[model samples]
Target: MEPRKLLSSLFYFSLLSLLSANQQVVDSAHHHHHHRHRHLFDFRPSKLFVFGDSYADTGNIGRSLAGSWKQPYGITFPGKPAGRFSDGRVLTDYLVEIGTALLLIAAKFVGIKSPIPYKFRRVGGKHLRNGMNFAYGGTGVFQSTSPLPNMTTQIGFFQQLIKEGVYNSLELQQSSVALLVLSGNDYSAYISKNGSSQGFPSFITQVVNQLVLNLKMIQELGLKKIAVTTLQPLGCLPFSTAASSFQQCNGTQNALVNLHNLLLQQAVAKLNNETTNDHSTFVILDLNTAFMTVFTNKGDHLGSTRFENPLKPCCVGISNGDVCGSVDESGTKKYTVCENPEAAFFWDTVHPTQAGWRSVYSALQANLQQL
Candidate 1:
């Protein structure tokens, strides 16, 4: 899949997992208020540091430079383009929405909202407590399609913030969760550079090695927990499945994704073993299984909702060459949107509809318990 498309898909999956977990907490709270309160108090973190690509980025991308900032992107939520690649709220926005709701309903609880993007933290104040987001859309562990900072550079920004005393050691040690999302932008770049299939395995190894190093560095910086997402099945994305009339996933592409996830799991295990601490500091969020479950079930996981054709997007360009939100020189719209986005699984050629994400979260309920 294309890097940008993969980023959006993974972003939705990540947020779906988060929202699913939060919903469970909310449900438990309703059933057993005191028990849920105690659980929240015990696990609440003081700050959350987000890194990776567009999947986790709240608003790090430049408005004018990114297509996300254009019309129809945020038509569902904010009712205007809000720098999100979807028709409405993307992953990070949903995180904030759920967190805010938690704060309102649970008075004693202190919910962790999506962090401010690193670019907008220059005028930092109380918002710093929520931590900072260092992700950029279209970026990867290595350079990708975007001119924005890569994973290494994003980490450098985090290091700079710590060095400048933006976050004290005591604060970091007390409570902090670092979310690292690397959703295959590196592979996309490699393919675009004419890399061969034979060289793909070695390339994946290199990516995972650097990722492991990055996680360790975050641990050394005093983060108690670091969650890294396993890459989702790339072949199952709309971009790849389009060739099959969106009916079946490309086996070759999915095989590559499995290899990447296997290596990542091994690396996380090693990192945990190397740590002197008694508890695990590094964890993997299983996106592959979650995605497969939802796709296989065709959104039937949710009792009340059943998408007719889960693979067919709700919005698309008028023809093959066009895309969702596309327009001609004369200012003519070239795309079509479903009357009800809730009935479709995908919002575009790349990203999922908000309802689609909700179902995905439902499918991921079991896996999210690991977090």
Candidate 2:
């Protein structure tokens, strides 16, 4: 075959795989309220149940106070903040792939509608019955960061839905994939509360322990596959690297982050081994490596994405008294925005642009297939 034809064929095959998977999800969701059913699914999940903090937050945070809600955040896609913490889509949006043929077929066979009507307009309400997200921004595995429910409490909400019969076990078994993201809000809170570096190791262990427990709980609640994230290079976040003028990542902080990721991998391994069904029940999405790849390939990656300076954020405060979302006492805007948000990777100080998330999503495409 010609090179162009070969590439087109590969793309079509991938599209077919996604459509078949989404169809199964629609079929399973249909029978949940009527009768229990089971079907083996080996396709990428169409529905994404996002958890964790800002990295995966999709408008769960309030607009008035969150930096994601301010100007220049969504300048790339929506032309304004549409509840994402970044200038465009976050990890959740890019991690998801919705093919039109699948949605149309689902609408025909299942008589279901898409929950996000504007985005997936043709699909009816029945399609949305596959999954619903419950993540909130600024939250941690523990109860210290955001006023919203922590990881435990978030699980509690899922439990409540189960009790109300919103999700039957069969539907959970067939169509569900949980995206659990714990990107270190707990550690940030610990440091802000005066926790010392000497205690960091122990705290890291505690966080991992809690995270493992959370993943187990999600599994116990009947989710088929749980995709937990290895924490990103925390020291590399623009917020932490700013002290060095965003030119270098803090090696010490990255070392600590590696320890946390090591523990998480171990926990995932144990979970996979312990599963009675002998399936690849637990998978760790390697966000750390993906972030590093993007950083190291900055020149090549940025040029491809049309980003001039990927590390620097598009919207930022001019001084210490301001932040991306802050306003002056006189009610004037205190932040500055780059001429083109899509040309930058970092959105504010810590978050990535939609383009950045797309890059990370591409890196994790293989891992996401398990779900």
For all predictions, the C-alpha RMSD in Å is 6.4, 12.3
Q: Please give, for residues 1-371, the per-residue lDDT of candidate 2 as tens digits.
A: 33222212221111111111121222223323112111223434445455666666666656543556666577776777776777777766655543222221122222222223122323545655545556666667887634667778877877876797766777776666677777676776676567898998898789889988999888888776676667777677666667888788777777777777776766666665566673325655667766666777673233456555556777778897466766877878888887766567677767777777776655444323322
Q: Flag regions of model 2 displaced more than 4 Å.
A: 1-46, 98-127, 299-303, 306-308, 366-371
| Pairs of residues at least 3 apart in sequence or in different chains that clash in candidate 1 | none
lDDT for 80 (candidate 2): 75
Tell me how far the alpha carbon of residue 208 in candidate 1 is from the true structure, in angstroms, after superposition.
1.1
Candidate 1's residue-wise lDDT over 176-283, tens digit each? 777787767777667766889899889989988988888988888887657677776667667777888888876777777777777777666666556665322565
Please give the CA lDDT of all the candidate structures.
0.66, 0.59
Which candidate number would show the highest lDDT if scored against the true structure?
Answer: 1
Q: Considering every candidate listed, which one attains the maximal TM-score?
A: 1
What are the runs in model 1 whose C-alpha is more than 4 Å off? 1-43, 95-110
lDDT against true structure, model 2? 0.59
